[model samples]
Target: MSETRTGIETNPFDRDHYDYSSWFFWVEASEEQKAEQLAQQEQFLRVRPDSSIGERCFISPLAAIQVETLTLGRSSYISGHAYLTGTLLTGPNCTINPFCVIRGNIRLGHSVRIGAHTSMLAFNHTITDPDLPVFKQPTSQRGITIGDDVWIGSHVMVLDGITIGDRAVVGAGSIVTKDVPAGAIVAGNPATVRKWRVPELAPPTAASVPSSGPVPSGGPVSSGGPVPSGDPALAEQLRAFDQMVREQAEEVLARSWDAATGRYVDAPGHAPSVRAHCDAIEVAAYLTGDVPSQLSREEHVAWLRGLQDPASGMIAELDASGHPGPRVTDLSVDDAHYHVLCVGYALEVLGSSLPHPIHAVDELGADGVIALLDSLPWRGSPWRSSNVADMLGTAVLWNTRAGTPHSAATAAGLFGWLHTHVDPRTGMWGADDPRSGRLETVNGFYRTARGSFAQFGLPLPHPERVVDTVLAHAQDARYFAADRQNACNVLDVAHPLWLAGRMSDYRQQEIRQVAARLLADALSHWRPGEGFAFAADSGTGRDPLAETPGLRGTEMWLAIVWYLADLLGVSRSLSYRPAGVHRPEPAGSLTSQ
Candidate 1:
């Protein structure tokens, strides 16, 4: 059977056939035959009372499923005369293809694709008594677990007590005996890692415009289509969502906006923060059009101008907004980069431009640029390094758009430095911090990639590797829980998937599924009148980070909703698109090499 196999004769995914109350062709069976099949199924259930079958699961009548305990998950099925015995546990979206033999205790995670004629045995016959017949020896249950998003090709035989790691690929006709590491591509008998499906850094794109010339006027902006859903209420729901968001925004402005300071605080009680004001632009732009981004541009611009220092043209981190960035400057590195995003982009959306060149003309020489890149705390804090990248990318881009002095040359050097330093293994910045694992690094990848690569329409250095890594991070059970998943984490994951999806088609269908699920889950974060919470149900700072419902959460999550919906081809239902930082646009000025 093909990896793309839906069903042999019928679409096994048909909801009508998902029910196993009467057995195969149960719908067509006579009343008497249906009753008989029901009794047989009842007897099977009674014998194995530990079975926990999820919704929309299909267990073919032809398949020989004799098990002590079974935990088949939703949207998963057993087909093709499969020989399944003993205890079996599988997460959602798994498939045990036709003619497969799964024996003993087995555990499979979400989206585990077991191809046709594959066999996975989890127990071994005790060989202590060599004199005794092999059949007479007692069996030991050593469970076999195939991790999430794994692909076991046709005719593969996973040996007893084997554990295949997440996002791994087992070639067709291969035998897996040893433990396969995560992100490995293994083949041959007694499978060994042939080549790792690890991260490969994306290459830097060339800046085509002249060094001192002005960037072309119309740089492409990323957006999604009007792909509408069949659901009739979808349009109304989107309109309602918009209205609610508008209501929330209006209420936030009324309550959270500091009339005296001309800045918007996240919430009523919190002190005015730079982040709140920055997020305001997104929320306002999201509601209105992206061209004239904010509600009141003149006031916001005046306020933003006050924050900039006269001598250095730098903006300092005002208050705790729970954002991370390069901590290089008092307006030098960290704040400068962050302002480039908040202040710089906010101005663009407001139908204006940055008041001054971010870094002075010729201030960032080749050596200075390299120093800035190197100075970022890549090892201890990658998130900060990525912030710096965002700042540099934005600075170069903004300059290029204005045709500022040495802007094109600056982009060239910056791209060159990035090309030199990107991690080959992870396709992100720096090595994975053993402290936080891929959580921090993957999140950091978004900040840098979004600004440098996606913002400029440049292909990622290692789009495939980046996609795999980002998708892998989502597998962590605790990190992605709907109740606990935060706005920052989901945005980090989503933007990367959306951006990388534009560059590569590797496992894209799976990516679409993941996005759709995540979009559904993220809906829970909505707070009705208050708008979206940074973290679900964490109204007043869930952990060290205050993720309760606020403007920041609304801005980030609304952006996420657009991205996920767009990826799933249902953005048209939303009736709006992101014109904010989260947008995925191709490079207009820079030519792809």
Candidate 2:
């Protein structure tokens, strides 16, 4: 076996070995230093009842293993050429192999084994300028704390400011850039959780159909097959309508694109919105096919690169010139949700080639986005409006689409969080914070929430109860204004219809009928030159509705059209964002295919 002079060696029959003599030089310790190390060891052993310093523990006579500020536990052994600084505390039976570099404050619990050639850096550089050298950049320090029974394998790089929890196993050659939970098995370039050392649960099985209860009456119950299109003429008409909407959507989206910056403008000469830009990409892709005009596609990519915020791992709004604008900090839940939605959509649309501002999402990919979400200040609330559900669901949907490992596991975690905050009586989200007032579910919350859940068909806790309450509200005359007029902003009607049709499995017949009625009413307004009118008055569908003229409500109106088409059985085109976006089937029958 090849061995260094300090007695650290490669395993028997392993010919490969690293020469540590040059960098791992042993400076001869003075008699005083030797006395100090021995004295400290003796004192530690005396004070710690369970501690033991094993016989013939290798402490090189010439090696610079600083004895001060380090507390050794029972039978703990550190091989030579391991440079350690600051205050380090090790538990009993800890084994630190050779060529391990540690700095700043560190705490290792019982039986922790740090493998060979590992580096645990507690201070990391902050690289703000690409032009400047990393060495010249400012540094931030956060100590490392490894819990008991943790095993970090060979050639691992643990970056600054993270904790490795108890019983965790960090795989060989991993780069640990984030905190790890207890009993996690992590690996990769920027280490992600491969699996949790958790108790296995029973696999999910198909839910049993209710044995004796009849489905609520209004519309027909699901046939457990494709929704049949009885009227082929209506199907053709709907297809033509969808095509027209796509064309109009394209024209509107084209105006939103800022070629120089690649960002989608909120309005003329206004700052670019993260949500709008991502949404525009999907619109462009769906309308023009996946391969948008090469120039437009390139510009879209540039917008993604320019809008990303490195510091917070968020994609922020940007000025017309491409400079980062207002952040999500202290923003409303709707605004903040939009920012997160933008990131998820980008990953879904751009896939692996998405740019990295600080290499946050790009470095660790989906895990990076998860980490960014974790850092945000948003909290669980049952009454906090449906945007919360949309945000959570979007993250889950996009992450799943990105082909990230353990996406289901991550999504389950978010769903659990959502479940805990739901109001038991109302079957909707309620405020979790005691000081916060009850916020009503309005302002497009129901549609957004319903659309989000419908996208992935993920299981939600107590789903039946929630569906019952929502249905009751939909049937109440007071809920839709005194006259219960379905005609309003086009989305008000189209949105609920899409939500109703897509979620038919869980919804009541009354809701579906209402949605169908609203959709028909909205469609009646579609005009040859003016397009779908924004509203319908007493028995008359008004084209170029007098309220809010000049393309007002046009953007959301197109979104509504897309959602309705999705319910009508259209293949989802890549030109739209996920979660809130739906796929249509069964044409006018409004059923999934």
lDDT of 1 by residue, 1-593 (tens): 21112233555454334232212433353455445435655676677654556555556666798775576656677875789876677766688877899987576756788888999987677697979999998665445656667799999988764667556789999998765644568899978767756433111122321111111221122221112242445445556666676555566545656666545777766767776777777676566332123344456655665666544446666644433322323334444557667776565444344555665423675666677788888877888788877777777765554445667667887788888888877788876776566877888888887778777756678877877888888876567877668787888888887776655556766777678678878876786566676777644455634555678888889989877765664555553456446644432233211
TM-score per candidate, in order?
A: 0.57, 0.45
Clash count for each candidate, listed in order shown:
12, 16
Q: Write the per-residue lDDT of candidate 2 for residues 189-233, one digit (tens) a residue.
A: 989777755322111122322111111211111111123332455
Q: Cα lDDT of model 1 overall?
A: 0.64
Candidate 1 has its poorest 10 consecutive residues by lDDT at 209-218
